[model samples]
Each structure stands twice: as structure tokens, then as C-alpha cells.
Target: MKASSGYAGVPRWVLAIAIIGALFVVLPLVAMVVRVNWGQLIPLITSKESTDALLLSLRTSGAATLLCIIVGVPMALVLARTRFPGQRIVRSLVLLPLVLPPVVGGIALLYTFGRQGLLKAPMDFLGIQIAFSTTAVILAQTFVALPFLVLSLEGALRTVGTRYEAIGATLGAGPTTVLRRITLPLVLPALVSGAVLSFARALGEFGATLTFAGSLQGVTRTLPLEIYLQRESDPDAAVALALVLVAVAILVVGLAHQASLGNAGGRQRLL
Candidate 1:
């Protein structure tokens, strides 16, 4: 396509570098796919351990997605609409986990929610133990995944601007009405895209979940953790599990791309 578009301005070295970068990303995935045991793929991933991890991943990730949406949408709205002291700092903090190492984030969660940590007395009195539990898995997933939803939703809110909201207010609509009727519909695509990205991130989460939730089989052993364990003695099963993740990643990208296209089409229709 670049060649067909009359890309005469591009230098040979630039194209070479671009191809090399693409190869770096594509080669490893291709290797995984190529090495997959085609005949035993089904049996490998459907085994008890595989099924447990896969199911746990889906459940925790789904819970995390819901948590992100609930908390993240409001946070995004606040960031996009409000002006206050240290606003930049708040925004940075909201996105801090995105750049922070997963293991580091897990430790942070541990400090905040662990038995002997900040909320220890409150949790202990209530008989709630978060760390090293399935609940801990969901909590850790939420910690790492929240930023994806927030950043995407905040961008969406800004792109939507405040024109419609202002008009609605001028016409006697309350803030809640405007938000429910105008702002939400406008940002629906972004919401879906963000949620998909968050779910994918949670599904692939490893370091944080491992540190916070522990790899207890049928409890906290998610797909990635399971893949790591399988690699030691069951390379074929690991490959099969890895393929499952690759398929999920592909689906997530496809959904986000489709959402983008839908949003573009919606704007064209509005125009």
C-alpha cells in the first residue's frame, strides 16, 4: 500500500527499519503459532488445570472490567470536566499504574489491602482477607486495568467536548439529564473500546496477580501463571495456553478497531 501510494519521499533505510520493527513484534507470535501442537491443542487446553486457570482468568478479568467501568467512568468525567488544584498530579496518578511495573503494583496493593497493611484492622474486624485470595486476584486486576479505561474514556470525553452539554443545560436540562442523554451516548464507543482493552490487560496480567494473589490452583492460578508452570514440564500445554491468549488478544484488537470504525461512522452520520 505504501508503494501503491507513491511513497517516493520515504528513504530505503526508513522502510528497512519499519520492516525490522514489524518483524520484531510479529516473529515471536508467529513462532508460538507455528509451534502449537495442532492435534492435542484441544485436549491440552481443556484439561482440568487449563480449564481452571482459563475460567478464573475470565471471571476475574470480567469482574475487573466491571469495576473499572464503575469507578473509571466517574474518574474520567472528573478529569475531563473539572478544574482544580493539582489537576495534573491527579491525572498522572490515575495513569501511574500504566507505567508502573506489575509486580510493583501488586506490592502496592498488598500494602494497601494486605492483612497487616493499611486497612488491616478494618478488614480483620469484618473477617475479610483480600490478599492471596480470588478476591485479591480481582482487586489486582482492577488496579492494573483501571488506567486503560480511564485514559481512553477521558480522551473520549474530551473529544466529545461540551457543546451538546451546554446546549442541553441552556434548554433547562439538569447535569444528570445531560450526562445521561447526551454525554453517555456520545462516548459509548469509547466506553466499549476501553472496557475491551481493560479486560484484555487483566486477562494477560501476571506479575501483579502472582505477587498479590498467589498461584493457588483452582483459586488464583490464572492463564499466564498456568502457562509459566506448564513451561517447566509441559511445553505443549504451555504452547496451547499461549495460543489461547493470542486468540483473545486478536479478538480484543478486532473489537477495538470495529468500535473506532463505528464511532467514525456515527460522527459522519451526525454531520
Candidate 2:
């Protein structure tokens, strides 16, 4: 006799609930698509303000993703491959931004980098101004995006384990050499997924950027912020811009999903 499928064990009620959950997530996107003024979509999204916001968002998000990869790789390596005092606490703190409200993050950033902040003296001594600048927007995006990369890469590293690294060391490979040759190649797919996710998160960043950078067209006003500002004055334009943001988000999410699948496939092959 033919065997039952794995999902055959799921109850009808569970399937019904799952459908509801999917609809709950999907219906809003459907509604937004329906609300878009197709005839005016191009004109609306091509406006000077919209273009500026789009370009700024892309630039900042790209920079934030790069920053996430640079710092997050080391952080994941430390968390996954090393043991030290307060390690748990450090990991928790590193992941805090994932759960913390964006506004709260912005507030934290403000006090840490703002004019009258704790670092004010040092900042003034160096003649560096970070608050309410484009740099502040990039920093805010990085602050929130970093956790995604760190979490993804760390999990991947943990799963791949240190066996290969140990073997490399036994063969006279130095720590850096082992990491460069073995560990990173093993988790490259995860790193790509994490970086893409970070870019997506940075693109959607609004509250922290608003609080920290203070919206300035062609400067700090990213797409999400632009959508908010346009909501009152031009609902149609806002909807159009929102759709653009949604499209970019969908592309990024799709890339991340593919990368994750590759990561899983690689792990299976390794095993």
C-alpha cells in the first residue's frame, strides 16, 4: 500500500487556521495593490521627492547591509566559535535591537551620539557631528539591520560546527587561515541571506531614522519616511510609493529565501 504523506497527520482545523493566517498576511498586500492608481503609478513614483527618497533609501540600505556584513561576521564568529566571560549577556545585547522598538533604539542612539549626549565631549573634540545628518540615517539603519545578519550567520556557524576548523588547525592551518578557507565558505549562503535580510530591514526603517536623522528630502528622507510624509498631502502618491517599497521588499525576500534554501542544501550535502 502507498504511504500517507507527512502533512496528512495535520488536522483539518489546523489547516483552516493556517489558511486564515496566510490570508491575514496576504490580504493587506492585495488591498494595497487594489488601491494603487495604475494609470498614475509611474507619474506618482517618478516625482522628484519620490525619486530622492527611493535613491536615498537604496544607498543607505546598501551601506547598512555592508556594515552589517562587516561587523556581523566577526560577531557571529565570536559567538559561535568562542567562549568567554559574559558571552550570553553579550549575545543577548547584540540581539536586543531585534526585539527593541525602533523608536527606543533611536532614543538610545540620540543619547549616545546627540549633541548633549554622553559622547558629546569626545564628538566635539573631534569636530564630528552625527545627529540629524545623513550619517545618522545610515547609523540608525545599521543599528537595526545588524541583528538580522548576526542571528542568521551565528545559527549557520553553530550548525556547521567547528569540526572542519579543528581539522584545518591539526594540519598546521592558522586560525585566520582556517576561518578564511573553511568556516566562511561553509556559511557563505547564510551570510548572503542575512545580508539581503539586513538590506530589506534597512529599507523599511522609519521610526529610528525619523527620530535620529530628522527627515530632510534628498538627505534623510528614505522611501518609508517619504510615504508617511506624502500620506496627508497625496494619498495616491503615497500608495504608489508604498507599492514600490513593497515590490523591492518582495524581491529582497525572494533572494533571501533562495539563499536560505541553498544554505540548507549545502548543509545536507556536507552531512
Go through the candidates in order and give the C-alpha RMSD of each one to the true structure.
2.5, 1.5
lDDT of 1 by residue, 1-271 (tens): 5353324777777888999999999999999999999999999999999999999999999999999999999999999999999999999999999999999999999999998889999998999999999999999999999999999889988887899899999999999999999998988988999999999999999999999999999999999999999999999999999999999989998998898777767666765
lDDT of 2 by residue, 1-271 (tens): 8665446877677888999999999999999999999999999999999999999999999998999999999999999988999999999999999999999999999999999998999999999999999899999999999999999999999999889889999999998999899999999999999999999999999989999999999989999999999999999999999999999999999999999999999999999
Runs in model 1 deviating more than 4 A are 1-13
Which ten contiguous residues of candidate 2 have the minimum total lDDT? 2-11
TM-score of each: 0.95, 0.97
- State each model's CA lDDT, in order: 0.93, 0.95
lDDT of the structure predicted as candidate 2: 0.95
| Top lDDT hit | 2
| Clash totals in order | 0, 0
